[model samples]
Target: MLGNLFRAETSTLQDPSDELWDALCGPQSAAGKVVTADTAMRVAAVYACVRILSETVAALPFNLYQKTAKNNREVASKHPLQMLLHDLPNEEMTSMDFRTQLMAALQLRGNAFSEVERDRAGRVHGVWPINPDKVWVGRSEKTKRLSFEIHDGDMRTLTPQRMWRVAGLSTNGIIGLSPISQAREGIGLSLALEEHGARLFSNGAKPGGVLQVEGKLSDPAYARLRKSWSDRHQGGANAHRVAILEEGTKWNQIGMSSEDAQFLESRKYQRSEIASMFGVPPHMIADLEKATFSNIEHQSIQFVVYSLLPWLKRIEQSIFRDLLSPVERREYYAKHSVEGLLRGDSKSRSEFYKNLFNSGAISINDMRRLENMNSIDGGDQHWLQLAMAPITQSREPSSSGSSND
Candidate 1:
């Protein structure tokens, strides 16, 4: 089934155009393509359809093969895969086929699929393989013959040394776009994916380290460690989470006298300094020092990350597991729904939030402050995404009278 779509889409493959060659250089190329203005319009429509389908399908239990999870009774039987299963239930139709069609739609729109991954922290991270968005940083390579500049949008290099960036895949290591490729800029690239953007899994992603990312792991050996950490941390599923919290609280009681006080009170501890502080993990310092609050962008990132640390891995699994029970799946749906409502507007203003009474991730007020901090960079189309992005919201309380629910 997928083969047909691939054949049909590339059926007209003439020699690759210079424009096409330049566009699909590396990791940013995954977004696909947009040949005509009409293709853009069609792809926009398809993009929406695909997103809805992706979410619905992402939530399905594998054996059921129904993305709606026995609940979306009136979804009108959407999704090509769902329909294929419903009508034919034959071996011919495969997910590869669905993917081919999706890729065609993306290519038609001039977008490429670059890799994306969620970290153990449930923070979204990704690199551009062929970005029409051009939000990714451009790497400059000066050759003796000519200076060919590569950005996230360009992936395939004429030269062997050019990097093979992957889009739509969860990559942790910075893609080797070029010797001049900026890792920090790639970190900014990672920041672009926003909240649940990363496709990684691990309990500990200390952002402060001088990251020497070589590649992204579609599946890693430590994936289970991330699961273990995430359940206890992200979903409150950890067997020892209670013990960790108790120990943490006990340590917090005496402030500077605490055993972990070393993480906080040193003369050099400052928010801007955390990223550069040699070996200290940013989260450790953020929790102990709480000094990142001074910088709005950093503060929100700190809070959002800190708030979700325990649950990161769990959220990572929850975000894409086809194994959730119907009830469990619905809960995920409802929570994201409310978050979506908040996020869709892209302009929620509040000093802090009082949520998370149940998750026990952090104190409600503290969580709110984190939310306020994270809201700095707007334009997340959904709420949980807003939860991940930097907020420009103030530390002052909200007057919008949003329901606590």
Candidate 2:
């Protein structure tokens, strides 16, 4: 059923032009603050957090399932929706790349959008992503329904049904509240700190100081002296170089004392704040000031639970609501397999599987499947703890005249 849609074909879509990119990049937020994707990525912590989230999500597997009344479990199937979602959203991109891009957009802009492609029969065949910056959501005056308008040289309006939008928290539900817009001060502070550090390191990695000369010089002489000093001593390469001062000349440190500067502390604090805004643990973004072995492991779990789960749920619900047909919706649903992320160390997993296997909660085959190991013969049988007999059986007399301890 999905063969035609999944066939190999090249996409004819062109890259967004500079003009379009610029239009989408800035000048829209109510706070009058503009944070471009490129600018946000300049911050190492922000980049790391975004990468951790998007890569984690993109690596996980997704499945489409149909529930049958006769069967107790959902049966996995190779439906067209699965092909479009798990294999190829469009001919030009693979599923992982598409999801990674989408996740990055969501993380940075607090919104993501994709256009649905349908054939003559109105059956969805493909999904094409649209830059979230270029798309704006509005409510129709007549219909009073949410609609998305895309600006790509020309303006085109799309009904809510035709677009898949994953948005962060919003008050109006029509448009998402941008994290960059809401936390503009935090982002600005982080960027300013980074720029300050770069400039400080660039100018010989020293604090600005005053050169006390014995006698005042003409403006031209002073300018020439200053130019020569910078030319010979400025930048990281000239760091720690000996300065040649003229007779009766001395250098006086004028800027804030390094002890009071607290540059590293301020940068670290900003990193924590930025990570907090995204619900990511500081250690996940390499801020290891308070990180320990135990806490790091816990933070890893916290990242998946608190940070990525909401994003995953949003995508799952969006696919279920927008991609599935009316008939398919009744039976089929989309889900991301988070088991890989939830798995613990090998020893812990082994103990967990052993408990479940002994208690008859899970079969040997199920344990093997979870570990990605081939099932052995007779592994389908369930095992119960022999020591824990039924209460009624324990009270009954033994057939072989066994004495109770």
Candidate 3:
């Protein structure tokens, strides 16, 4: 489905630059680890952070609005782009699913690529997500215009204008620099440690140890003894089972203890490091070692402001630049309504809506819409604070000390 979405209309083709193809197919991370989008996601911290960010971005409602000329108020309106964005981004996925996968690609690969399907009128009809793993971006040496090469089963060159590209933080503007690439060493090390620990637990919940036989046996006997012992006792199921030591047999523990090795601490630290690399709060990624009640709320807000804002902005700008036609660009704009995520608990939200309603900043209907409740009749009327007084009416006592004037 994704492959068909990214197919180019024109047969015109260009080969991906050798350097670009190599970097994409076998990118080396700062940690000297081979970090592909799929492998990076295998790291638990990486997966958690990506899920947190992508799901948050996807959960927010995206809408198109037109700016009214008189009051400059934003009114919800439909555009040709809405047919794709608000309903189905592609034939296979709904809007949320499309955004979630798109954002996930962006989070892991530092770029999300899509092809904008157009009708005969040259208006956007659908948006198809392209797998970042299968896509490469390069600039033409002569024209300097960016081109996308999508390698599904076959390679095809995409017209840059027909592609929707959102790039993350980058030293070079053409392609996004991946966070996974930069932090791969730390994340890779953590993953290695985790696998090693799991293996340790699996193979009898103990680190390497030595088994000594009191009497030296013939080569075959020694081999048989070793294999027998392992088959009987080497595994978690055999852990803590009483071992009957025969004459001249002993067991000696070796290797550092998990504590001495700082194994658990290393895992925790690496989790935090991975979260930091992705601009996610460690607590959000389930690293709550230092999280407190007061700080968690602040952290949640910071996730929205610091972590997700830039990504959301990237998507928004891409939508405006690539999806909107010239006329639509003049009056219509796309924005994600993040109010739902930013809203506090019921009490806080109630107070917030109450204040807004009382101050006439938002009408009853507006509040209802935000709460996902049906708008009541006449709820559009705005209300202001009830108390007021004329400026000329002096409330202070005059110099004569009269109670009333």
Candidate 4:
């Protein structure tokens, strides 16, 4: 299935033009740094946000589900595409690896593409990821349908059926805008600040300070003094070393500049800003300055709701649209099980289950399944408290008491 997609039998597809390469090179930012998706990753905050989101999404239980007659859904374990999605997307990559790479690409570039390979019977067999850099999206002039031009040693055009795309937030509904491109100024500034801090420490953590002498010295003496000072104090290894002055030379120390002091604060702000841009909570990325025990759990929940849910929905909807045939779409759908992420502490979870069980909203077997425990026999029956009754219902008069009254 994979071999047929890469065969060099293409004729009409054109090579990607130089204009596309220039765009891919990315734009220069206000901080005077080029902020491409690759370069933006060098910033620690960007890397952390991407890693948190991608890993979290990849670790989730992505499964194909079938709608049952009872209005409930069950894992489509017997479906052929179920194995492709749940265990392996292709021969070369496991589900986790494939999802991680695809999600990282979506997070960084705002779009991810994979070629869907189907067997002769029109059943999906494998899915192979294509680098966003190598794929170009366009619409046909006559049909006005979306097409993807892929350049992997050979150019090939694929229709929407063969190409699966998971797009992030989009304005045009056709293509997703890259977050790295949209937030280049902030990210570039972060990269520049990081570079500046590195350079500051690389020079023995000393901004240039003046050395005083009692009298004027010759050019050779001055040169020797400068060389001697650098030899003794330069580089991070020599930082904070005590210097011995000779020949009545006095060392005048320079205080840290205002900009340097603000460097730390600026970096902190940028970290929070980048996290916000990615819809990740500050606590998730270890930015807990304002985080407290009271709100950290809520923040984590918000991360799953506000940050991860949208991305998961996009992937799920894309899977339903791209992987399943028109006939199968009505019956089968893709979903990620986020029940684990949304679970609270053990005590809280116990209370939740208790409430649901008492209300007969969930049975013992359902609770056990949620907790990943084997269900007990006859545990599927739902039960509610028999004593519970509506407030408007009056108690029935006792049969023997009616005569006594």
Candidate 5:
């Protein structure tokens, strides 16, 4: 049934439209650099942001959980879907590799696609990632339902059930807008600045200065003088070298302007901007200008809460919606364990665990499990402070009806 539903057709010989051609060629930024997902990643900040987000998500523990009879939830370790998601997504890739690829796609292209391969019983057996660039999303006019057109070797159509999609921020719910395409101008400017700096250094790290002479020289003499100067002191290796002046010629050095001096500052600001574009904290990408020892920990917490939480929720919900069947959805859901990212220093964590243990909120075994330590034989029992009493009991008069001597 699944094979029949997915129909493939060979492409017909036709000229591509201008829009299609432009997409194939990629967008040219104002800085003259071609800005695509692949090209944007060449920028250091862009690469760092994507790598941080993708690898962070990939390292997290993602697994399916089932609702228990006691109204709690537990990891469905034996479930086929659980094993597929937590250990391996497909034969070709481990769960981390698959998740990292999909997340990187989401960070770069604003969308990720995966084909859901099901067994004879309609249980999901494997998941295979598809390149976002090769898949086009559209709604069918007849049913008004979403469909995916995969442009691999053959043009194949996949129904919503057969294809899993995770989209980033979007104006419409169907298609996600590419961050690289939207922020091309700023990224292009960064690229241009980087290139300019490289060229400036290559030209001896100084602006072209005027050469004063006693009298006007012929064109050939001027040409010969210019070529001689360039050949002696054009590259970084020849920078700051002593020059011999003859024939009453004088070298007037040009000092760098304020704007030129601020080139490094501009590059730093652009790095911050790129980090902000991906919702990453500047300190996370090694931008510690405003970060301090006192507040860097707080910033890391903010990164997990403000930046990483939304992406985690998005992926978790998408998995629940696209991977689970209607009946399975009622009882099972997916989640990523963010405990490790949110964990504080040893002192802070010890205090936290102490408070929770005293309040009987968590058992010793639970804390051990969170710390990835082996549980003791009797660590399952929850403990509470024995001296703590209810407010009403504290307010009551003594039964002996006498004051303490």
Candidate 6:
């Protein structure tokens, strides 16, 4: 038990030039000892965000910072494809999709535009058939400034995540992150206004990270901008869980065999319809489909085994200084194996998981593992360590004792 408190070698996440996609997706290899289950999960979530960004950006605009319907109000977003998003599962929109969309939206805020492309010589340029608004083909002056300010906001919030989604970017794959850790990823999003760099208080410096800044726009416009950015970038623990997917309900919104249709149908452990309360994309819901589930029955056992499970081991290793680690969390022939990772014949996910639970009670290690798995990425990581820091022993009691001493 005491052995669980390990420290991984603190590795800096390097920015691979032209390899932002590679970095966002993940590094080709990793070495440091994984520190703790909590840190492990955060690291994994961070990777997930990175992968979301890498993949989404490479994939394009579909999922970045989509709008969602609040309350009983019917959903509609700024994107022309708003109607399509409103019909998606709420989980898809608010969580995974929401995360990706936030990154994409940040990218857009920093540099969104609708226009034809031209070369330096000012020769004729080809017109893109796609709608200019949906495509993040380039950045605008205002948008760039906003993007920088948004990154500023991230540092100010002191939260590690900076993600986005934009409805106009792509037809699928909604989320993205920068230097991702699960609870949130630190997004180094491309902003529109680079001219006024690092102007926190300097004159003529414009704020990029803010939805609204002092002296930028009128109160009404600023109010709308603030609300819009909030809807676009909201995540973390404070984020509301829009809805949970239920078993036996199929999300057949995109029709059979289409890419959208194939995504949700792949979650074989259970079936459910999730309306994207947020006006994001169908694929966004599918991105982190399994992570949000509270119940074991409908949990993304397969995804946990493949993508997320490794994180736990990494955490355990780094935390405990790399002792007694599993080669991988899921078995090759196990029941919940998905098409991508597993080696052979598959069984029902529940049946596969049931065999592991045959032992009636949970292990001490399992509880520890779960505790770390469920930990958030922000200050909680330091709460215990900070509380236990050593202090100087007092040579004299320097208290007035309420002035009655």
Question: After superposition, which runs of candidate 4 have C-alpha atoms over 4 Å from their true positions?
Answer: 1-26, 209-227, 242-261, 390-405
Cα displacement (angstroms), candidate 2, residue 84, comes to 1.7
Model 6 scores a TM of: 0.17
| Model 5 spans with C-alpha error above 4 angstroms | 1-26, 209-227, 245-261, 390-405
| Residue 55 shift from truth in candidate 1, angstroms | 17
Q: Model 3, 265-321: lDDT tens per residue?
A: 888888888888888998888778899998898789888888888888888888888
Q: Where is model 1 poorest over a 10-residue stretch in terms of lDDT?
A: 174-183
lDDT tens readout by residue for model 6, 107-168: 32221221223345432122112221232211224333112112212221111112111222
Better of 2 and 6 by lDDT: 2
lDDT of 1 by residue, 37-103 (tens): 2332232222333343333333322221233455643322333323332333224434334334323
Index of the highest-lDDT prediction: 4
Candidate 2 residue lDDT tens string, 133-167: 67756555566666676777787878766898887
CA lDDT scores, all candidates in order? 0.30, 0.77, 0.78, 0.86, 0.85, 0.28
Q: How far out, in Å, is residue 9 in model 6?
A: 19
Residue 205, model 5, lDDT: 79
lDDT of 4 by residue, 1-405 (tens): 122222233322322332354456547787889888999999989999999999999999888999998899999999999998899889999999999999999989989999999889889999999998777776665676777888888878898889899988887776777899789899999999888778777768777678899999899999999998889888899898888887999988687763757988999999999999999999888888999999988888998998899999999998888888999998999999999988888998999999999999999999999999999999999999789678767777567646643
Model 1 lDDT, full chain set: 0.30
Task: Give residue 197's lDDT in candidate 1 (0 to 100).
Answer: 21
lDDT of candidate 4 vs native?
A: 0.86
TM-scores of the candidates in the order shown: 0.18, 0.85, 0.86, 0.86, 0.86, 0.17
